[model samples]
Target: MRRSPWSTLVVLAIAQFMVVLDVTIVNVALPRMQTDLGFAPDDLQWVISAYTLIFGGFLLLGGRSADLVGRRRIFVAGLVVFALSSLAAGVATSPLELILFRGVQGLGGAMLSASALTLLMVTFEHGRRRTIALGVWGGLAGLGGTMGAIVGGVLVDNLSWRWVFLVNVPIGIVVIAATFFIIRESRAIISGRRTFDVAGAVLSTTGLLAIMLGVIRAEPLGWGSIEVIGLLAGGVLLLAAFVLVESRSAAPLIPLRLFRTRSLSLSVVALGLNSAGFLAMFFLTAIFLQQVRGLSAFDTGLAFLPMGIAAIVGAVVASRFVTMFGTRAVQVVAAVISVIGLLLLSTADASSPYASSLLPGLILFGLGITAMGVPAQVAAQSKVRTDDAGAASGVLNAGYQVGGALGLAVITTLATAHITDAMTGGTAPLAAAVGGFQFGLLIAAIFAAVNIVIALLSPSVTVDSATATEAAELEPVAI
Candidate 1:
């Protein structure tokens, strides 16, 4: 069943937008949620960490399930789970209840996100059309991250913090309905003896969960804590077991052979590194805006708007350049731009105005990250077979999720340590905080700089062969 590719993209993008939006939307609402739910100061982190850990942990399973079950089926099921969980979260009377619901929401998010990307890949044939569609997808994703703060602020200020979760209800319903009509059900066509790798799934899921748990707790517990060390070691051991299982299984959960694809392998590596820095940048920036600058939630969110706009523009520019030049060149250049952005950001201080110090760096970083991201995404998906779309998508998304969790954990610790030392050395509170942020941004800059080498390792591929004829031959979609 052939559906209009653009229409398919719209539905998929909307679903993915919700997934990404939830990652940061609650950030601005944390204060209100803490007050209303009577959450302890330390426990508040669970509100965010729960969602991230579950989402990151089960992504591989959710993605592979889409292939074994059905992409459209999993997508619709995810929406149902996500919507119900959102409603539950909105009305929760206690912190524990809200945290549990958020974890469920993350599970649904993993299901939707992986399948949506898979369906998009199968719907749009690999060519200029797919690249353009991916560009749009990447732009909307970046927009969602930026818009989360804005939307969360407005909802929290005008309505209530509950609206942050409640907002997804109507949007989820509409998208769920639209998805059935727009997306055709698709799944991997297995040859024979369809065997599910149960051991692989269990090991990988538990392993990821353990690692994410360790990372999330590291900030409060300290990285040197016995619990953190145990969790990290256990996760590594489980993942090692998973690798062994995959190598022996006839129908592996994640085919070890897929990593043999240079483009996909390199793309995932670069993305993981890029995401580490990107998430750290946002985390630090938000803290600086709210803590040091003493901006209201709404005002802090507004400060991020320019970066979002720059991200959209970057996606468009990257798509064009990939068509004209190639993936490797665009990725290399984008990495360089991101490094410059981070460097600029490091220069900001307590007295520095937003317009003069922060805005330029935000815009440049946003543009560079999104631009580099689109090509890497396209290249990764392009190199994989249709049967492995869900697996590949899952791996890609997991890289991003885990990278963010790990990055925020390490980066925030470094920043906090710096601030603690500065204060001990007789630095003022404001100056110490400012110095901490600068140091964090510098570390993030180093992460971005590493991407240049990673990008250089990409296989050069151009989408120009069908550019002229394909553009002329494309049909206009009312959607």
Candidate 2:
């Protein structure tokens, strides 16, 4: 059966949006969930961290599985798991149950998200069609975080915190039903080789999970505490071992050779840095609007609508710009724009007005992030072999999640320290909080500045019309 490209894109985009939305949707509902479930102050962090740890840890494995098993099959399976787990989360009567269900949701998200990108890459030709498809993909990706807050607020305020998880049930079911009709199954060709590298998967997944856990715990545990140090050290050592295992494996989970492509390597680095700043902005901004400005959840979500709209517009513009110029040039320009936005945000204080002080910076930040993200995604996937498409997508996403986790931890620590110092100096509580947020914004600007340097130093690669056409025609090869 033939499928319309537009239909396929719509279905996949919905799935991707749901997965990404879950990341931030819970933030607005956290207080309610804690109160309802009787969660401890420290344990509440687990609601977010649990999902992140599993999602980041298993992304590579999930991507590789999509290549080895089948893209469409894995995607459907992921949706089922996601929907079921979401249902469980909604009905959870205890904190442990909610956390457990969230972890399962993350596992499903990893599988669905990795497969969705690989499927998109294969479904559309790599020319103007693919570029446009990725533009929509990038735009939705940017909007999901912002929209999560919006949608979450509405659901929590009007209904209950449970609605945040319950909402995914209907969306997941629709995507799953659509998948059977609109998506085609594709997998890497395997000869007599082993289907997967078990050792590599275990080592890599455990290593990444440890690293994420360590970072998430660092703020609460004290960065220099023995537990944090031990976790970080163990994670690094395991990752080193995973490198050794992959270097020699006949069927490695993530091909080490992929990094040899300069565009792929640099794009991954840039994506990580950009995500670090992007997510930190979302986190701190939400806190500032609510805690400092005294906005209701509904109002805070409304405040972000302009930024979400701007991100979609920026994504469209980025696609056209990438088509006209090149990924390297567009990325550099985008990073510079993001730095300017972050600096503008650093000027915010307790008395700053939303329209005058916040809106302008939010617009620039939204535009710059989507612009940077679209090109980076396109560049990362440009040079990969068809058989390794899933792996490439997974690695890129893993970088984003890992970078976000680390960035949030580091920036939060800096903000907390600044707030304590300011309070000690006799600053009022509200003033101290605003000052800390401003400090975090400054550090976030530094992260974006690093992205600019990376963009400048990265090798230039252009996807012209002719080259894109050639890439579109390339077929999968049997291993």
Candidate 3:
């Protein structure tokens, strides 16, 4: 049953990369998908949201499933489901069909993502091996932004958007086969008789769906709209109810007690804020590059390659710095560095050069993100029972999804309002609308700075993996 740690890392990273890459690959293809599928501008959001919302909403359940069933089995099952769904999506003739298939793909993606980390944890023994693995996993998440831009442009421009989905087919087959051969499976041990938390799952999932839907609709419908208000309210109430139910449930899908760790609580908050800034920054910058700088799609993708490479390099360095610099110090310093990057990004104008103005911020942001995210991820999963890796992973992923959703809403609203105000008296072209996006980058920088403040105040942060619990000591992969 033994497998080389390297084999396990490679398999898990591929799966994780696919899951994360999907988050952005569709960005460049939105226009083509709409034209071919007849999806309206508004409806196109679902192409992205459908995948993320389901993936985020069901992540907790998926994590728990991995523990109860088996990590390796669920992992492979997820890939099969994902691959089939991708094929369905690639060939879909209608928006509705594509959306449905996208949701299915998200479900499988959630399951695969939920198990991948736990397997990585169990595959590599605690100590240096785990750290390197974690660095790889964490690094890949950051690299997704750059890769998505490049791959999306190539596929959309040269071939077709469908390649984004079809490309997954071969990759999925290879990863699934390699995983089966290289990964060891683990199952959760239950005490006496335990029941699944059906009520808790229903409440939380519905609650999250409501909140996510409402948040995403804020810009289109206006936050003041009754429908948006109602959904948000209902989401908050259902989440509250879920918490109450979890308190009394015999076996909660999400262990409420995990929040007892000071480090875990702080890390999640930091992760969310950091993600908010990170996601919004890219959306804003891409618009700036294309609309403002007049860069071609291919050029935009090329512009991002450096940031991607820097992320991997920075993450490996950050992981090593954990023990020497101390996790908390690195976190605070990293947040500050990202803030500086965000600050630099805010200065970018139509006349600024990419190499000088943008590169500095991108590099700083890359380094800071790698440092903060990797450590926080390691910290969040460090104390939980190995069986709860899925839950732990889901929690971190939730922060990521929540942050992105919240950021998208906040930035879109702010940017639109500013742009609309400036052009209210005149009929401005699409360029004026794009100007609004630049201000969104400024707002995103503000959010990044907020994360820095949060990191600065969290004196409880520690990076020594030993400080994390025995079962939770598995290293993070930069993937």
Candidate 4:
């Protein structure tokens, strides 16, 4: 199959958007889901965590599968799974059923998202075209969370919470049908010498799941609690075992040599740190708006609309910035901007007006994140070999998912402890919540500042007109 590059991008971007949107779409609808399904308060968290854990755990395996089998095949398979699971979730009669379906949705998302990026990489050459494509891709990635909230709100308000899941069914079907005609298949040239590293995959996936479990549970259980400590320790040991297994495997799930590329490694680190701060910002701000500012779900979603718009604008401009200033410089500037935004947000309180205090910070953070995210992705993918494209993409995405999980856990814990202290000191509930959110914002600012340092340390890599034209001339893969 052959298709116009733009059409191919549209297909892939839509798929990516659907997968990413699910991450946060259910958040606003949680209370409704709980009431309908009779969920216990503690068990409600699983509705979100189930998707996240499975997505994070299987990302590497999904990426590697794309490399070994085929991108188009994995992408289509993922769509089928995602759509079916989404349908199941929509009609779920019990909390356990919804959670299980959501886990399946996450698994499908991992396969789809991992291959989607790899497909984009293969379809576009590594220069201007790729940069522009990635900017769009990264912009969508940034927009997904905000959009999810918005879409979830409208659906939940106008129809029902189940609409959020049902919506994916139609979109998935359209995408799957279009994909077969529009996208071509591509995979690494397999060799008989290579074998699947089942042991490595098992260890890495289980290790990551355990780590995320520990992190998520830490919010409910104290960080110093025995269960938390044990889960964390076990996770670390399993990951270590994964590394050892990969070192000895004939076909490792992730090539350790990929990390030897300083740009890729540093970019991955920056991506993780950036995601940690960015996602924590979203988590805290959403809570602040609803719990403290007394905004309804619909209003809260509207509040974030500007952030989504700003992110799209920033993403559109990022390619040009990368062309002119290089990835390292853009990353540094973006980090600085994000830090300022976080700091601005830290000053917000119960009395702060939305326009004066909240909006400005949201805009700045949105702009900074899109600018940083696109270029960081480009930098990481720039030097990777075609054979390792899926694996590399998986590693990058894993950094994002894991970082968000870990960051949310740590920041939430810190904020909760602060809230506890304030309450013990006789602070009002709402005031304490606001104070705790402010503290979390401050910590998030620190994280962004660290990203600035990391970005500054990264080696410079720029795109020029010559490279752009050269890349455009290269032939895309054909099935």
Candidate 5:
């Protein structure tokens, strides 16, 4: 008997991991980037936000474009563009140049990310094949954040920040070559739509940028400032308009009907927290370990091993767990577990010992995070037609990316505010910074608790795949 025609999972997983790892790898390099480029403390968020904003903003369009054009072609194109952008970013001499190149890199990431999973889904037929492939895929998601930090620390400590971006150069080339050789072109289920949803895309992306900027800037600008208030209002209005436009359009960027699924809807909200807590923790922990606790990049990265290993093991474990007690139950428990970890993290301080203080929190957080991997992925893509699968997955991907962007902005702003406020009259500013980080992590824990409630709304069994269009369709079933 002939084997099913599956694309190269190894190449795809490696490519996808590169994209995900890039998200955090640069973080360990942030201090170096800031010093070399002479970036102001306040202006530094751009370095991080540059990639995420573009990635989140363009994800839907990228995903839809793959369906309209061809996944293999788009995926390869994305890799080439991403590789070039990495080179440009690595060699950048000025802060402005780095930010510009980072944005370009983000564009490529958006394109690659939007289509990678779609290709995988198409490559593997449903059932056992799909299950194994997805496990590998999900493991990448768990490992990416941790590995990025690990690699970033090693690179930044040994070579330079440039190495962080430069590392992608070779990896990208290899993935592209392998993709061409091992991957086959797959046509979109439906083709030749009259017009793309350009207007909706513009509105949605602009709105998201406004919101993220507002959140990030609220630290310096103050939440009550007109800039924050105006951006928030504008973002809300633009997003509302995006929704209205999507409803009226003949060819919508996001088929609003996808929200109809309870599982998909709730999973998105869950993923938002997952992305926020998981990714943001990496950023915050790295900064806190080095800046406040006076640890080196290598030390900070080494500290993350426990959490990283746990996330991968947990995700693999979750695949088996979800098949038994069902997704909803596993997710609810996962949320609670992660929340506990965040709560533990809130107790972290500049003077805290790695073993007595940070280790327990990271280990527990890793365990809970491990639980969320499968359910969130499954719920997000459980339903929907195979044709719309790319779009559907892109929705969750956007949520994940956008959520991380928002998390960085919101948590960073809150921490900054708390630190500034606490540093009255010559108080130790560094300690204040650590305290601020704790405050931010606490807020993240609260956010995850909301995820727990959302997960509780899911069902004890797998959702039916027929009516997966509605965003909140599967959510109601969980309750």
Candidate 6:
């Protein structure tokens, strides 16, 4: 007998959680890792950048691979690579080794994340079941990022910073083993010659790499720097070439026609903007709590617990509401809530108390962001063809990563300038920093507000006849 679809979802969710958690888990442990590995201050950023660059860069390729190759095969392969890299990263004696291992870990993450989503999409039939599954997937993914701070802080405080990386070993092993017993292999059925879009993959991967690299370095090197400008410009040109090639190729990595699907296209844009605002809030708040309020990493993590709870509630609520009302309505209402949350957060200062000032905003922001995310994700997958599911999911995921990088880069730059102005105006250093963060929070609020328009533009209906057709095309194959 086959395993339950819910059982497969559990396995995939666990793996996806592990991958997304790594995106921010290292934030609290960076100092410890730097000191232990003898990292220069300037070079310390590489530990984060390397992973982001590689993971975001290769996501498109990884997702498409899931379609061409077997999804289960790619998923298992990703787990092994990720687990081994995590082990090596934890044991590294030098900064270079750690960074190298982290980059490799990112490659594994790209594969694992993309295939996991494909498996979920193909496993669940369209309608309420798929919506619920997507909600669970989206919620866990969002929570993973928030929980990273808590998990990292606990590990670094109780054990060593190495535990942050090493913790994945057992989890990965269990997930990999469970996959063999529970999940069946599945691949898209191609009618013509099974040719991979080699040219499209290369162009898109390298182009995205260049873009991520440019964005990551912009804060340090300045956007106007020759290196940053060259990388960004080159990435744009390469992506343009990739688009051109895709239009001509018989078997494109990403079908240009997918963009014509209004629901899918709009949902992707909405998700990207959702990530931009949502992630920037987390980044800014972490710094605000640690630097301005002088909270220890552990304490800062504890303070975020309420927000995590709120997010869980929001996720559940969004899933139900979308079924009752539709994605467009839920998204708009949820985003409005997020805008309010961020605006409330912007009023906080160094002297603001957690209970009175920070807690309320955190609760609202978490709820709104997660609620907003679920619908956006559901809408994106709602109209996708089964054969195109992997590619569409890849673009959706890539949009989230790239949008986040852009948000952080832009918000950080703006905050820095604000702080500089405040310091120059004779504000004390601590006060200036607070003011800058407050301003940054305001900008994040703006980003959240933009999602309202995207939500409005999204397809009005959630379930369509096309969804049933898509579901008909998917079937599970036992190995």
- Model 3 per-residue lDDT tens digits across residues 1-479: 34578878888888888877887677656656867889854455567656766676666777777877898998999999999999999999999999899989988988898888778877778787777777677556556655887887788778888988999999999998787678888977767655767687678767877886686667668889999999999999999999999899777766788788666777778877776676667656665676568775566667767766766666666666665766667777878888888778777777777888889888888777766776676666656678666566667776666556556656655776667666775737564655676677778778777776766665533555444322122222221
Question: What lDDT score goes with residue 423 in model 5?
Answer: 92
* Tens-digit per-residue lDDT, 359-392, candidate 4: 9999998888777876787777678898676567
**Model 6 spans with C-alpha error above 4 angstroms:** 1-10, 30-53, 92-100, 120-146, 177-186, 212-225, 381-390, 420-428, 462-479
For residues 172-201, could you state the per-residue lDDT of candidate 1 as single tens digits?
999988987878999988787767676886
- The model with the greatest TM-score is 5
lDDT of 5 by residue, 22-105 (tens): 887887788778888898665666788778877877878877778778888889988998999999999999988998898888
TM-score of each: 0.84, 0.85, 0.85, 0.85, 0.89, 0.83
Query: Ten residues in a row with the worst lDDT in model 6?
Result: 470-479
**Worst 10-residue stretch by lDDT in candidate 2?**
470-479
Which residue runs does candidate 5 get wrong by more than 4 Å? 1-7, 191-194, 380-389, 462-479
The stretch of ten residues in a row with the least summed lDDT in candidate 4 is 470-479
TM for candidate 1 is 0.84
Model 2 — TM-score against the truth?
0.85
Stretches of candidate 3 exceeding 4 Å from the true structure? 1-9, 34-46, 92-100, 127-146, 177-186, 349-351, 378-394, 462-479
Question: Model 4: number of clashes?
Answer: 0
Worst lDDT run of 10 residues, candidate 1, spans: 470-479
lDDT of 4: 0.78
The candidate with the higher lDDT, 5 or 6, is 6
